[model samples]
Target: MLASHEHYRAAVAQLNSYAHAYYVLDDPIASDEEYDILYHELKAYEHAHPDHIAPDSPTQRVGGSVLESFEKHTHLQRMWSLDDVFDIAELEEWVARIHKSYPNAHFTCSPKFDGASLNLCYENGVLVSAATRGDGIIGEEVLHNAKTIASIPLTIPHKSTIEIRGEVVIPKEDFARLNAARTKQNLPLFANPRNAAAGSLRQLDSSITAERRLLFVPWGLGFVREALSQSFYESMRAIERFGFYAPKILEAQSTQEIHAYYEQIQQERENFSMMLDGMVVMVDDFALQERLGWTIKSPRFACAYKFPAVEKITKILSITNQVGRTGVITPVAELEPVEIEGATISRASLYNYTDIEKKDIRIGDCVIIIRSGDVIPKIIKPIESRRDGSQTPIAPPTHCPECGCALVQEEVILRCCNLSCKARIVESIIYFASKRALNIDGLGEKIITQLYEEGKIASIIDLYALSVEDLLELEGFKDKKAANLITAIAATKHIALWRFINALGITHIGEWASKELDRRFGLACFAKSYEEIIGIVGFGQEMAESFVEFSAVNHELISRLLALIEPLPTGSAVGSNMDSAMDSSGGDFASSAKRPLENLTFVITGTLSVPRDDMRERLENLGARVSGSVSKKTDYVLCGSDAGSKEQKARELGVKIITELDLEKLIGF
Candidate 1:
């Protein structure tokens, strides 16, 4: 019995050491097989000699039963919140204040982990309790759930009663996987990783928390009976040696160093595995920290220099539908103007009626708007908890709000089929003058709107008839602006055929489709039958039917536009101008040597050597059809670093995958 107990004790220690190396140090000392064998052996011994089981044994991490409710736990040392500093000026002011008290004080800077604060109390080297930082003084006990975190040590070398405070975070990958699992089970998705980590830690069942794969990153101590080190940075290092995962800390003596580090972190934050809201700047010397003292709610010694918020909570004042150039109705949330990352976001796209229904977004509901650098502002989810009895459900409109035309359902979206709808006409004109369509430089949406509203232009055809005098009648239209606009309009009179087709704003036909249709029919698409359009490769029934219907309905308009403009056949080698557009690769597709990728379909994904659009253009110029998605029909998937779902789909379909170098070789470049 004694030998078995000794063996069990040895096995437990070995497994814990392996776990510390693998989870905390990110270096595995033992293979999975070795660890599993020992873990099971310890479990078996504990099963036979149940009374001999240690509280800190690896098996105890996930062996707890579900709790009915969380018990209140009072922290021995209060967990103080850090004062926030938004900009460098605010940080400087904060440092100046700190300098007044401790002039020689140096700081320890670490990532302000955007997660739930946890206070873990260890008595005699064994973790006895863990709790959430509810009100800083007292918190809800979550010891069982806390134990499930692999990075959190169940036992340490410190025998004194110590209260270590840390942030419990889920790595971005693990959070994604958790959300995916929840999606499979039809659960409400978490808004972000911080929410996911907080929710996981609060689970009634420890097993649920264990499944989340949470990480406990110790930032500082609440209280320690014995000091590890006099310096804060050295103390954190000592904690790391005692089996805790210490976050990377930078020692900064001056405010300039902190600002430089902040800038560096801002550039590299995206590369981090977890979300970092900002950096926590704390006095490195424990004596200085103590001397600086505390405020009513936070420590005077430490300040959180926060990055501009990527996610902000705002109230949805109303839900409105926006009409696109193609008359596709998109539900847009008119939000209470909130600033996110230095931009005032007053509107967010709900995408469609289906998305509105899926997300249960309602008028008067508080919603979370997510906007990262350059990404379009979007309503992620409505905060259902904040909903009151006054909030109303958003329903799809039966008729077009602009023209009062009956709306047509197309899959998940509603479309305004009326070609003469005022909104549709206005948007179409804007789209026609867009860079991709006509390459019209001075004609923007605002300019087009002004022209439409002032009765200067009604349709795409009317744009060509505009005079400088007509534009001068509207607001903000000077002589130079009007001339520029007229010149820009006149410039598109002799554009490529593809641009003309794209400018038409036909339903289901985008730039790529326009290019494909141009390649196949050139100037003869208007005369082509529905069956012929359908017979074209990659042209589905919807696109074919839309083209046929559009051609039939707008035959007069198209004929008049054709007479007004000289649309050169872009894909064919006709004039020097037309040849220049087709020979983008400095080679002729109509050459005796056939285009290598002719009739092949390629799907491009991830961060390629060049821009994605450039790569797609290159592939298209080589006579290969570049698709947005991957399927069995795809001949090859041109992939690069960090390829997402499309690459995975290609793998599943057994489509040939090639890198940028391989593509260069294949193209004989």
Candidate 2:
């Protein structure tokens, strides 16, 4: 056996060599598999011989590796942030300033990733470590976990140690898969995939990193070895030549082109393999990039053009049925709306059966479909009723179409007949790939549905049976795309086991709950038997029983399914408050003069129309809270638009019905 000192030195050499290949040369020597062996060995040695572990080891680059509890890491570089400008006018002002500074300045544009930024270090291109831009400098180390991502090459070709930066993301479709998985497991929802990915990467254990199937795209340039002489676009080209997956950069010939490009990309957002928040504009010239220099946070040379939310109108042709991972039957409205957003709009979500009942949406209804631009299009409401069969109620499916099992209804959701129902197999695969669940890349709704329909796949376990050739044969699947999808599936084996647990679409479980289980017991230990897990802090009888039941019935199935996933390391401990970790911005907003509501709830009605959401978030930040519907606890109802029932409800509850102006006065805004 090698001595601890030898092991330490060996690990350093291995990591450093990896960095060299990945950064300086853009070529790689060691495969990730080879590097992983060395790293794991080094980690094992360090655990056994902590004293021998060198401080400057590549492993030291990250912050939260193996930490049972995290001590706050103060950033070496203050995490100064960028000031945001949402619209074109602000973007124009920014450009004008640059033009004013150096007349004859033009711009170049790159696609903005809608994912989280990360600082990466490579000791010779074998990715040695990764950290979030937590506070700016010091961040949780997730080397073991990051290695699982296929796009993040383990070693570079030329071989020289380097630290690089990139964004960690889940593609838009993958975000949908994750959310679907979460829905099946009854997990709390994530607003978008960007939020989901950010949360996933921040987990302490690198093992959890493996399961997230995060894809890193080199966007902003961080550390460069040789003197660079190229345009911003050329520089990015240089970066890509170095073997990184550069962000998709498109040219905008005119303002219309720029808008069109943005719109085009936004329309295809769902079709992409990675998520993007906005598009970045830059000068293609290297000298121009240098001339632009850096702002406190963002570089002055580039500007991000944010896409507006897509909105459109469609007639509700009919309500459609969709089986979820947990077998919940969802009602979707097939539309005939002229596509206003980038892509065609043929469908919109009606949410659950309760929503259907509430909206009283019927077939052939003239409903307005809203896409919010980039995200999924959803049904707003029907324009009263045109020809009404009195707003036909969609009957819930009573049995699994793919398997003979009686459907069950609870909480207003129509669920499949059996937990392992054949119909649920496609749904499960979709859930497994959703943005909130396992976050598998390239696995989309139509694709998963097709796989099941073709009788080539069933159950989440069936995903493992797929070969690249299988994918290649499918429509629109290309060589690179097929490879990427296969790689993504292979990489998922190593994801945080809790993500797997959460992806199973269990009852009474969510990301938060899965995390709770991970915190209380490691995935391996927790999965052994439900009885042992029940003893955990919050594992009540109901939750405990459910956990046990799922395990008992699905143990073999989950085991086989897990075998298909690549084994990723678990996250280390961090300074996280389990309940509050979602987004730990402290305290709600309230004006000093008004005295913050401190969790006080209020309602809104009518249309004074500052856009209700705008007012709501503003109030929330001010410490005053707002709820959608009126309730007894509502202190005030800010009235706007067509105020009818809500206004009456406010009066009946003896609650104050205030105008938008009144709300403005109260907040002193």
Best by lDDT: 1
After TM-score superposition, what is the CA distance of residue 158 in candidate 1 from its true location, in Å?
A: 1.1
Which one is best on TM-score?
A: 1
lDDT of 2 by residue, 393-441 (tens): 5665666555655555556676663546765666667777886676677
Q: Deviation in angstroms for 550 in model 1?
A: 56
Q: How accurate is candidate 2 locally (lDDT)?
A: 0.64
Stretches > 4 Å off in candidate 2 = 1-93, 123-126, 157-163, 176-191, 251-257, 285-297, 312-669
RMSD of model 1 against the true structure: 26.1
